[model samples]
Target: MTLETSVGNTQSFGLSSKYVEKWEKRSSIRTRPEKKIDFELDGFFFPEDKQPVLLDGRLKDISIENKSELLIRSLFKYLNDIVTLEIKLINSACNKIIYNDLPVAYPEQIKMNAYTVIIDEYYHVYVARDLINQLKARYPYLTEDALPDSDSFCAVNEIMKRLDAEHHDLFEIIAVCIFETTLVKELVEFFKSESVHPSIKNYVNDHMNDESRHYIYFLELLQYTWDRLPDKARRDIGSNIADFVKMYLNIESEKEFNLNYLDSIIADHEENKQTVNAIYKGFEVTPDVPIVKNVISALKRTGLLDDENVKSGFTNIGWII
Candidate 1:
């Protein structure tokens, strides 16, 4: 199903028996391409504009081969992040709902759909890995151990560390809700980039198809949980949304990581090292505007942003004006 048709306004829909049936039928695992996707000789592994250091235009002397390495490595890091998010964060929270381990009971339909989400998420991991393996076959230099660390998973762990043990699962659900919602937007950018390889684009298309459904499911989950959460729990989770956004979107740290990695790639050349340092000195990390917008919209739609504390926390952090 197209995103426009699949996702209506979050407040307007409920997870009914009919919705579950449709979701399962259209899910990527059951319906997406089964054959291995192969890349074209000329297309990029990742978009050049999406890479901040490359986009900066100051590193004109960088070789085409090195730039390709950066792009391919960026793709590997992106795929690795999907593996981290789906298996580590989303599925873990889905397990909680499926097993009825949360502080409150979700609707029967919502619980049933968690099973579908787990299936879809695992399929996403499979698809991402398939692409990673394909890339590795061509670029023997790209190894799993060399991929960049996942900022999202690390951020989630830090958030969980601050919460009481009882609220850990609850916060996981909240974090995944924001993640799945924002992810739909992020994937669209990937799918639309013409410079990226067709196979990569196709993989993103398949993943986005599943993510669109997951987005609605998590929105429903958010509304259900927010209404039933005790006041103290609500305050605890709501108050931390801003902090979570900062860590999860750690724009500066991510830029630093990318620049440092690029420096490592060109360490032998003194002039290139100086250029990398200059680029890092000049580059600034800004919040992903579209993602930040979607996150706040999800919170508002679910009424979490209605709480004075929640709204105030976001406002103080400049996410809300």
Candidate 2:
């Protein structure tokens, strides 16, 4: 029977139910230790070096002006590009993989299929377009040209294209999972914080609420996929996951571009030499202070940062523990 037919006849009736049933059946019959393992973020480790930098003063302390607001709106345009790129990359990669290997009967296939479903629902083109329009209207300074086109999205598409060409191993998949899932979760939290701008805050809050659901779906799907791998594959997957986490942590630490609101804050605080210096220093340092450390730690705990594997890999690479 066709996959669609198989799904339609299933007694469970919900968007998520079809995959949930598939996972349940697969998990029930699995006998291997790895296959039986439950994934958890508890006890996950993050690098001491890759923490987030804490600003010296409250976000409100930064003066807000029309110029600053305009700058903040512009920054959102860039951020929107990043988000759109991420969604497209994951969706395209997953689709390409599944399309070429149809009749997906395995647990991994089911999980991947689930991810595709979640992305389709979460990143519905119409909904995203509407939201983007709303944001642009609210922040008049945002330029239409800043929006990412199919060709000019972020680095994610290129990464996925390379992975597809290389026929990425399980480790690579783990790396992707670490990056995509972790960012979605972390960005949600960052957006929800009171420290963010009011307009930016509202936008982020809406995205965060949707993202929380998406995060749960991805995590569950990853666990379901990981649990079905053979022993050697599982080990490889774990190792790759670790390596990817390390790479992500390193890259995240070096990201220094100012978001619109952040740039405005920096400009406002520029007159205060200590605060300006602190902000500058914060960007220069890797995972520097309590606030930053907590951010990375939280991401690690949420399965964004590769804890153990990254730690070991960094140590081997001669990066300070």
Candidate 3:
């Protein structure tokens, strides 16, 4: 595997653009289109601990307490953002810059790897869309608008709107790359999580396969970006990046959505208001959560956190411990 530690690519294969071909030749997921993609839902979506909130069902009706049904339904909704927004981030903006912009800016290193990223990201989007179609066919409630303010949707939109229009694509690349870095970390846990649905787990495993190759590319891309920039230019972006990270990754909106989500399900069941409130609390975002840790870890890896201004921004937001 090729990696950049701020010093440079750990291996020559990456900088020379040979790693792209090497990865293409070796990746089963890339070469094996015939491999079956399972769309079956395992009656649950996420690990219980990661759910918005949990109620001790022993106090309620067994059917209602099962939560298996409700959570699975929610997962289907969340995939709308998970899969499609990822596609949008990659296809809509990030890949475009890699294909058109990066090559022009850094021709020597970006020639092949950037295009490879475009191809692989599209494949991932296809896989997610396929799964979503299967899920919608199975569950009628899996609408596009089912879950508002999904993590991906929120993060992507926030960053896109924050950057200058002329540089929106470049900033979009940064936003998605940040998410991808964190995603690589989250997927590691997803692989280890026995509680994940089998179909979703396998799907994640496939996406992880490709992402494992890509995260370092973006990490290095950021490095390449900083190395090439003038001090003032770098400083400008550094400060902006800090603000972007804080605003884009906000979880308060998701918490509010999760709380309201209960209202939709409850349908004026006033008796269950307290139960819903408990679930609302579970959506609270903390710096220590696996997902947040991934973002921090990825930032540290980029050496982006080394910028005192950037560090200050994250620190103020309570994003980094």
Which candidate leads the pack in TM-score?
1
lDDT against the true structure, per candidate, is 0.73, 0.41, 0.60
At residue 306, candidate 3 shows an lDDT of 83
- Candidate 1 on 1-321: residue-level lDDT in tens? 111112225333435465578775898888877736565556777888787777445456787878878888888888888898899999999898778566777656677778888888998898888778888898887777745567678778888887777888888988888888776867678557777877778778878887887777778677777777877888887788788877786554455457666567656455555555666574422344666777777877777877876877777777543
* Cα-lDDT of candidate 2: 0.41
Descending-lDDT candidate ranking: 1, 3, 2
TM-score between candidate 1 and the true structure: 0.87
List the pairs of residues colliding in candidate 3: none
Q: Candidate 2 on 1-321: residue-level lDDT in tens?
A: 122221113332222455545434432112111111111212111111122222444544534343345334444454555455455545554544354442223334444654544454344443445555665666565665533343233233333343333334333333344444555545655444433445444444445544444454554444434444555554433444323333444323122323323454456534444443455553422345333353344344444334454455445544353
TM-score of 3: 0.78
- TM of each candidate vs. truth: 0.87, 0.50, 0.78
Q: In model 2, where do residues sit more than 4 Å from their true spots?
A: 1-63, 67-71, 102-125, 135-141, 144-164, 169-173, 183-185, 193-203, 224-243, 249-256, 259-312, 318-321
lDDT of candidate 3 at residue 159, scale 0 to 100: 56
Cα displacement (Å) at residue 141, model 3: 3.1
